[model samples]
Target: MSVKRLDWPDWLLSTLWLVVIAFIWWMAVRLLHIPEYILPSPEQIVERVSSSPTYFGAATAATLRVIAVGFMAGVAIAIPAGFAFARIQLLEKSLYPFVVFLQTMPLIAVTPVLIIWFGYGLVPTAILVGFSVLFPVLVNTVAAVKNISPRLYFVTSSMGANALQTFRYVDWPMALPYFLSSFRISLALATTTAVVGEFIAANAGLGYLALRGVRNKDPVQVISVVLIAALIGVLLNAASVLVETKVLRKYRD
Candidate 1:
């Protein structure tokens, strides 16, 4: 029942790592006398971001909205479908290969067709994000649940547990670790793919901002956008860790 929070030592080490990386970046630029156009120092990036905070802020908000919608949609559809596949042998045999094939196709190639179908907006972009994240979660969850020993099923049934009770008592708890592992991988994919989706066609978002920066030949703006994108990815990863710790605390112990 104890609430889990990120501990101080972890924060200290993470901060120290960031400082070391900044120092290395600074030293490289200073020693090499690298031109700002080639690689701006960390200080320069900060200044650039500060100069146009409003633009970056709006773009970040747009991108985050896409990420959230895409991730939630992916989770809602993938988990139950994964369970159904694992529990039904015939369905798995027939459909799993099709799922694998869809997952293997490149998003770049798929994006144009999606735009044609869904039109150039958030619909196609969000669908791309969902598609990118769906497979890993489905694959891992089904694998974990299906691999549970048959003996466990016998024990659950002997205890008078029905199908739903068996899943509640045994199947879900055992498969949870694999489900969570897939989540970490898929969450990153969702956010990154969402950005790539935006690039395919969008009027707003960090992707759009980056493309504008490129066309205008402004490296500073591009670097600033890159930093913000990295920060968003880190934040999403931290959120995943928080959920994992809270949900799986007993299992961890």
Candidate 2:
């Protein structure tokens, strides 16, 4: 295939945007004469990250673990629950309201209750992350599955396909794109909730590091931790997008 050249690829444009933003940030700090402790220069944040790579890396790893577990747990439970909601009208009618309520509940207010119930630790944090991501996945999956054309189901039934076969051959492929989209959103939410979880209670992770930085009057550390969190969110979102593109490429046409 022959391709026409473009001004820039998306990745290049993204990088350029970051650079432009950084330049503006640097200019703001310099022009405004903002103190380092209040708003550390980009250079200072980088210096802080570089100076203590081991520390930040450890913290990031800890938080990453929480995110991973929570993501998996959320998907594991939500997908099945979604299927149930779609397959059983009574179940959906009976249970969906509470599920929606859970989704709408404010996490900040719920955090202390979770702490009291689950206690201060990784488990509560993981649960928080899982809870935070669950509703999106559930809602998306049910909607996707339920939104399929009735003709597809009739065709599968005419072919004498069993429930499992129908799901594999009809529902799975049709629903995957929506599922992946929701999955990406859930993952981003999971990362943020994981940080919030750590902030509420935890010995390690970026949130804890940020808290420590605050207590110790270390803006560089706080900003460095924020930088790491932002990087993780970006990378995760990118990975999700790549996976969706690869998996959904055939569906595009």
Candidate 3:
């Protein structure tokens, strides 16, 4: 006889896992009698967040604003740069080393320069976020363009296609999937970098809140910020996947 399968929804499985983890955390805190300063219980974190929902909500919005500006700016620059790299050998050879060098430079170091140039507030932080979002998307975009079969280009050329037509019909469609796949990675980076920027120099955002919690020795506040950041990453990733699926389906059809 065959065993029956559960075939549960993906969200249900994820929820169950989250519940299990929370239960384990609760048990550990209770059994070990851990001090809240050292490690706040999950319940305590929830209580902290609930106590000042507006404060946390404003922090979330600020972080998201940075992430949005940075992520968009990064992708907007990276795609065209990738295309140019693929199309122009001289340009790529001349600039690719600099791009790689810039990537190697620690954001912590570069951020001060950005701060000096752009001043504080959103600009420097967003640029840091953009840096985090930039490299992966750029590399993927280049790979996507380069990986296209030479025969495909030949076919377009043989059909008397102009540069614009060739790109419209061949380059873009082939590269789109790679670009979308990179988007998921970039979104996650965007969140982390935004928080890091806040950590370095900002009065607001979850990173600032977390830093304050650290100085104040408030484990609950720090953990609450962490949970919120994780939630944002998950939601952004899910949204990217949904959009990718629909866009690919439409393109394929």
Could you give candidate 1's per-residue lDDT for residues 1-253 as a string of tens digits? Answer: 9999766787588779989999999999999999988888989989878887897899999898888888878878889889989989999999999999989989889888987788887777788888887899899889998899999999999889998899887988899988888888988898788777788767788888888888998887788888788888887888888888888997757
- Candidate 1 yields a Cα-based lDDT of 0.85
In model 3, what is the error at residue 143, expressed in angstroms? 0.5
- Which residue ranges in model 2 land beyond 4 Å of their true spot? 1-5, 250-253
| Candidate 3 global TM-score | 0.96
Question: Each model's TM-score, in the order given?
Answer: 0.91, 0.93, 0.96
Ranked by TM-score, the better of candidates 1 and 2 is: 2
Ranking by lDDT: 3, 2, 1
Deviation in Å, model 2, residue 66 alpha carbon: 0.8
Q: Write the per-residue lDDT of candidate 3 for residues 144-187, one digit (tens) a residue.
A: 99999999999999999999999999999999999999999999
Worst 10 residues of 2 by lDDT: 107-116
Worst 10 residues of 1 by lDDT: 6-15
Model 3 CA lDDT for position 201: 60
- RMSD of model 2 against the true structure: 2.7
lDDT of 2 by residue, 139-215 (tens): 99899989999999999999999999998989899989878999889988999999978988677899999999999
Give the alpha-carbon lDDT of every model.
0.85, 0.90, 0.92
For candidate 3, the per-residue lDDT at 156 reads: 92
Q: To one decimal, what is the Cα RMSD in angstroms of model 3 from the true structure?
A: 1.2
